[model samples]
Each structure stands twice: as C-alpha cells, then as structure tokens.
Target: MTSAEASAELRFDPPGPGSYKQDPVHFPRAATRYWAETHPPAFARGTADFASTYGMLLGGLQTAYVNGIAYIVTLPAPEEEVPQRFQRAEEAMTGKLWREQLREWDEICKPESIARHRELQSIDPDALSDEELAGYLTRCRDHHSAMITQHMRFTASAVVPTGDFLAHVGDWTDLPPAELLGLMRGASPVSAGASAELERLIAALRQDTSAQALLASDDDPGDVLAALRDLDGDAGAAVSDYLDLVGNRLLDGFDICEPTALEMPDALLRAIRTAVDASDEADDVDARVAEVRDKVPAEHREQFDELLGEARLLYRLRDERGVFSDIWASGIMRRAALGAGRRLAAAGRIHEPEHIVDATLDEMCALLAGAASPSADELAARAAYRATHTAKDAPPTLGPPPPPPPDDSKLPPMVARLMRATGMALGALFGSSEAEHEEHLLRGLAASPGVYEGTARLVSGPAEFGRIVKGDVLVTVSTTEAFNILLPLLGGIVTDSGGLLSHSAIVAREYGIPGVVGTREGTTRIADGARVRVDGAAGEVTVLA
Candidate 1:
C-alpha cells in the first residue's frame, strides 16, 4: 500500500466494542500513530497464546481500543460449555507458570529492551543518515511489538487466575475487588519511591537554608531543580536522579500523546513540595488484608490462602508491567518524529517539529529520505484538526457492538462464578456510568476506600498539572503510570474516565487517599477550586462549597 493508504489502514479497529478518544487534552499525533500501527495488532496476536493456554473466557477479546488511550475490551457471554474451560484454566494457575514468565522477563526481555531504549534515546536523529534513521524507526517498531507481546502474555496469565480467585471469593466479600486488589498490590515501587524521595528532599531542605529559600521562591521547577543541584550534594543529586527516572515515562495514561514527568520538571517539583507538607500517612493495608482474610469462612480458608498468596505475588507486577512495557519504545519513536520534524522545519518542509505527529511513520521516513511526503501546510492542518477534536467526535459504538453477556441468574453456580469473574475484570477495564444530574454529588465506581475533603484542582491536561496544590483534590480526564509519583500530593482523586482498576484507583489505594473514578465528565462538571468531598467507599464525590 502507499504511505497514505498504510497510515489510514493503521487507524482501523476491528468491529467489536466501541473505541473512544483518550488523552483529549492534547492532540495525539505520534501516540495515535503508534497505536494505530503497532499496539493493537501486537496485543491481538498475543491473545492467541493466552487463549490456547488459558480458556476462551480469558481470551474472549484482547482489547477494544482503536487508536487512543485507555480503551477496554468486553466479550459476549460465553455458552454453557465455557465454564468447564475456565475451570481447567483456573487449575493451571500454579506458581510454575508465573515464575517462568518472571524469569524470562528478568533474564532476557527487560534488560535487553531497556538497554536498547536507552541507546536509542541517546542517539541524535540529525546525526543519522536517512537509511540509519529509517533503521531506528524499524527498531522502535520491533521493540514496541515485542514489549506488547510480553505485557499481554504476562497480563493474561495474571488477570485470569486472579479473576478465578476473586470469583471464588464472590461479590459478597468484606471488601470490593479493586480494594482487595490494591491491598494485594501493596505500595508499588513507583509510588513508594516517590513518597520516599519527597521525604528525603523535605528532610534535606529542613537543614539547608539555601534549599529552603529555593522552595519559597516562585522560580520555574526546572530552575528550582537547578538551584537545588547547585547545593552540590544529596539534594541536587536526589532531584537529578528523580528527574532521570520519571522523564520519559507515560504520565498521561500510557500514550506518547502527553509529556512525561521529566519533560515537566515544574509539575514534579510542585507535587514534591505538596507531598512534603501533607500529613497523610500510609494506610495500614496489611491490617486491612488480615481483616479480609478473617472474613473468609473456615471451609474455604485453605483455598483462599493459596489464591491470596499467589495474587499478592502477581499483584506488584500490575504497575511494574507498564515500566517494562513498550511505552519507552513509543517514546523513542516520538522523539525521533519530533527530531525529524525539527530538521524538516529547518529545511522549510514542515512548519514545526510537532507537526510530524500528523504524518505516518512511513511518511516521516520519506521526509527524512528527502522523498515526497505531506506538505508542511497539510501537516499543520492535520494538527489543527486534532487539537479541536473531542471524544464527542467519536461514535459511541463502532460498527455493531458485541452482544451483552447473559444475566447472572441464567447460569449454573460455577458458570455464574466464571461470568462474575470476567464481569469484574471487564468492569475494571471499562468504566461504569451513572445517570447525570443537576445535583453536585457525582457518582462513580468505588476505587480506594476513604473520605477526603479539599479544594478541587481541575487539571485538563499536562499543562495544567502544575496548578495542583497540597491538600487539593485532583480532577482530570485520567492519569497514566507516571502520575504515580504525584498521587501523594492530592487530598483525593477524581477522574472523567477509568474503572476501579484504573491507574488512578490503584495509586489512590496504594497511597491511602480517597478516590472516585469513572465519573464520565468530572473535569467539565466540577469547577476548579471548589471544596469537594470524595467518599471512596461510597463511590461518590460531592461538591460542598
């Protein structure tokens, strides 16, 4: 196919579930290019292995997102025979398989891929010959595809068995699925590291008058980081290391459409400042886990112990999976596109470096090769179109939507368990919606369990993230893994999209903050700086002042 045809084809998603535009705060050209071309096909292909090893229920659909961020997949209810398949799959969830995957990732996949990404990140696109640049593009695609395969495989193995355990627990348990999962996941390395880093900075600033003065000033965060570095010791080193770790991370929900924490040092600095002053303590999550364990009846206690142990083992991987995933690879692609765009701009080929996002990878290759490609005017117009595009521009359902799952009452007890297990998985992936109202209280999925009241800070996108203050409630479209570093600064969290298992929910629970997720339009409906109360257990956020 021609480059344009190939680019258009990349936008195509199979007819199953509806795909919506995520990361609407900014126009996502490069991110869309990656998803449309790479992510989906790789994910779908990996699901084949999952289905072969697990059951049809676990393999019903790989994912449903077309070309945006945070899309979910839901499959039609299975026939009666499917439960037996699920049962066999549940039986195979032993420590053996999980261990093997972990071993492979540690021994082979992770180290190699990370090294490659770091190498690519260091390369100057302008220094490469056109062929070399094209070769980097190819490397980015291959590495991204490999990472997706690993993630999907690992996730498929983890989610299914965990779902089986939850199915065994039933919805009538003492804690909800998301909360229990959070407890199992514990404080992720990302969140805990962030909290500890801030604490370190705070402690250092207490002793260093010069550092304290830097904090008091209204200097840019990057400038603040620089000033801290000038202290020529741990404080500067701390800021430097933290920025390096978080810079290229997927901050606005797993897509390259938005900048990473490193790219926005000011926001990270503000979040650290907020965290230093906050009084929130880590919740006694272990005690909560013990309480839930005590709630299990004697008859099922043995099995519960087995499953819970395994769940906890696999749980920490939830956040870490993204760390090892292809987002780094995607970042490489984005950097290359931006670099190429800059060169093109210098040559008067494109109006700006960012307009490269509007072109396909092939078109970009062509531009780098001094071949025919989209004109600067065309790319600029495409960028303009993306900026104005909103989720409303997307059709609710693309093609015929998949049939809904059958009612719970119609199935046998084991089958019913399987259905509920899958339902919980799907629910956590796809957010719930409640009827809209004029009342100030907004309803959503109960993610983390707590109640918090604070001034609401509506952050529309990355640019507005610096506005968040200590004790402020964060209001946004959604967050990605990178925001884990800043979750401690918020009094509570609310989102326009995401299910209980969303990044927001998981991070809030880990940090012991109140959170209401999947409020379809929380960003639009909740006014910035309004006093709001988030009742996480009740899944509601009420604007009180």
Candidate 2:
C-alpha cells in the first residue's frame, strides 16, 4: 500500500479533547488493546502524584490511543491551587525534596515493589482452574495498572536532579550532555543488567564445572536453560534466583504485548553466555570527572560538585523505576493472558494463543469464561494490524497545537527554579536536536561519546535480537531500559527516536559504547549487515557500504 493510503486507512478521530503528542519514546509500536485500555488511568494517576508532589501548575498527563498509537497531553491545575503549587514548588527547589523521595524509593518503594512482583510471579497460572485463572488475570491486570502508576509517581524525582545538574553544568562549562551524563555511569547498575542475583549466579557457575559444561553444551538453548534452572546445589539455585529476578521481565517494550525473557530462550541463553564470559574493564570515571570539573568555572566548581552528586544519587531511579515497577508486572499479565490463550487455542476457541493479547481485559476474561463475543477472527485482525502498523504510520500529533511555555521572568525565584530544572530535564529526556540528514548519513543527538564501525543489525523487535552478534551495531526505532539485558552483545546503538537522556543513550553511556540516537531514519537508511561508522561524538552515522 502507498504511504498516503496506509495513513488514511489507519487514521481515526482523537480520543477526546486537547492537543496530543505521540509518545514514541515509550510506545514506539502500536499498543495492544490490553495495554491501551489499562494504561491511561494509571498513567494519569502517576503523573498527578508527581505534579502534586512537586507543585506543578499542570495537573497530570492524559493518554489516548488512535489506531493503537499512544498520545499524551497535559492537564491544567486548578486556578485556586496555583498559589499553593507555587509555594510547594519553591519549597521543593530549595529543600531538594528528591533526596527524601530517593530514600523512600530505596528503603520502601523498591523493596515493596520487588516483593509484590515476586508474590504475583510465584503463582502458576496453569495450575489454576478456569474460574481461578480468570481471577488471577484480574489480579495481574490490577497490579500491572498500579505498577504503571508507580513508575510514573517517581518521574519528577528521577528527572529533576539530573536536569538540574545538566542545566548548571552546561552553564558552567561548554560540554554537551553526553559528556556530563558519563558522570552517571556507575550510578545505575540496573541499566547494565547488573544485579546481586547475577553476581551470585556468575560466582556459582564459575565454581561448578558441571553447570559450566551444561551452559557450553551444544544442546538446544531451551534445554540448556531448563537444565541450568534445575541444576543441583548452589549453581542451580543461583541460576534459578537470577531467572526469577529477570526471566519474567519483558525483553524489549513496556506493554503486555511484548515478549518476556523466558519467551525468547535463544537470546536469553546468549545473554547468559555473554554475562558468564564478561570481565570487568578498567573505568576512567574519576579521570573524566576531574577533567570535566577542571573545565567548570572556578567560582562554580563547588556547586557543580554538589549538583553532580545529587544527579548521580538519583540517576539509578531512571531505570530502576520502570524496571521494578511495571516492566515485571506487565510480563506477569502477559503470562496469564498467554495461559488463557493456550487453553482457548487448544479448545479451538482462538486462532492463535498470542492473539489473545490484542483483547481487552474484560474480553480476555470472557474468553477464558467461554464467552463467544469478540470472536477469534476479530482478535486475529487486530493482531495483524498492530504487527503491520507502527508509530511511523500515525500522525506525529493530533488536535490543537500545545500552548507555549509560561514566561519564567515574572515567576517567583523558587518557582522559577522548579520550572526551569524540571523543564530542562524533561525536554532533554524526550526532545531530539537533529532534524535533517544527508542520504548516506543520519544525524541525531550525540548520546554517548566515542566512535565505532561495525555491521548494522536492524532489529525491529525482540524477535530479531538473535541476529545480533558481539560487536554488531544495533539499529532500531528505539530501546527501553529492558533492552539492557541484551546490550552487552552490541558494539553500539542507533535509534530513530529518543534523546540524550533516553534509556538507549543512558545505557550506552553506562556500557561505554558509542551511541547515536534520534537519527529519525537510521533503520530505513542503514541496511542490515551493512558496515556503518557511528561517530557518536559527532552524532552521525555513515553508511560505508
């Protein structure tokens, strides 16, 4: 089909009122009915919580889906609350309230979220009866929704301090965000797929010769993984523990429609192999920190140190919030849906088990309960459309244009600080700088420093991950924090969307790999297996072949 014809076929009226911008940063692909239906309310609640906590003039964000693409718009806060919000913003700026929020995340939020995920994951959906499975799906959906909100609730705390550091450091020195963000390299271990469980697994595997032999065996990847998980003693226990932490988590996107690690055994096994073979490399963080600090104006050096400390302190939350909050929960929900789908497919009720993910929660429950509405054919069609279409097929925006930003000149000093810090951080988080490029070259944000030339592996989704070998450059639409699990296998990363503060950029910097993001056409311009040079410092990708 022609581009215009496809666009027309997919176009639909806006869900409600107000201007809406596509959120390709999070949902680059078309969402399934299950995610589209449950995401909005939870997202709105979470953003509202962040706004109230930071005293923003905006109430929270609202989402709507058109042709399965998610779009978002900000709601306005009540006029009467503006004064109170201003007061609170002032207090938040001066007090650095994110510190308290950080402590809460570590001591309360992170642990509690992990516990909840473990509890839900422990239940075997296959063991439950039809009625019991329906109830379990309901619980999964509810928890998934709550986790979405939880992920958003800490959004401000995660972004503000990092943005504050960027803003201040940018003024004090002429360095780009990519260089400054390198200071955050050691902060978020989660972004590098590091966990205590992983460390333990590595240690145990090193000592257990039999487990090592099994991992290195030529047996089917699935069988190797199963044997590893069931192996005897500390080695097996450690492998099981590590899988419990990561196996159920989505390997790519955030939605229930995305496949979990366990679902992609080959890639998961490869990643495990890579992790086992990986060794610690020398870190130049201190030298880089000192070099950047020396460049800052003498008068601002002390303040720069303070700002850098705070940014690093809160940087882990960037990935931790999403990874701990909804990513795991969404996978659990997918597992339950797949369980129901398996039974339905076996009974000849659905065309395919995976198609059940395209159904709404109620529809899924009904299907499990043997209802005939939303027939198998209808869901199959939905799945086909979602697979065929993406954010590229949808309009960049919908409804009226967004209002201009409020002038900070007349705002109170503290309120201005709040607005400036939050605005700068958020803008860098989502906005890309490069807009145009030459035919052989794709320009984007210089997300990570250095340069690398390698074969471009075009991966549209997790299913394509197996094509990526060690030192291959990953070219795709975008990547979420969950992609970190497989990042060790890549030489570099290039994306069509996302900015310097994006997960793709953050993980690349943490891994010390060259990364050019927001190229807008990297996937289209660079062919798979084509040798391409990625000059991340220059924000350019050149197709040499």
Q: Which candidate is the best by lDDT?
A: 2
Tell me the tens digit of each residue's lDDT in model 1 across 1-545. Answer: 44334345454454454432233322222335545556667876666555545544544344444444224354432466476665654544533355566667668876787777677777877898778887887676677787777666666545544666666665437556765665554635554334354557777766777777887788877888777767867777666555555556655654445566666787777766765566656566678767777888878888888767765666555556666576566566667767777888888989998888667778888888887568888888766654544443453445454556667687555445544655666457555557464588898878877899999999866667778777799998767665676666788999877786667777887777788888887887899989999998888899998
lDDT by residue (tens digit), candidate 2, 433-481: 6568987888899988889999999999987887889899999998998
Deviation in Å, model 1, residue 27 alpha carbon: 12
What TM-score would you give candidate 2 relative to the actual structure? 0.98
Q: Candidate 1: misplaced stretches above 4 Å?
A: 1-31, 57-91, 94-96, 126-131, 171-175, 178-182, 185-187, 191-217, 226-238, 274-282, 404-422, 433-438
Which residue pairs clash in candidate 2? none
Worst 10 residues of 1 by lDDT: 20-29
lDDT of 2 at 272: 84
Instruction: State the RMSD for candidate 2.
Output: 1.3
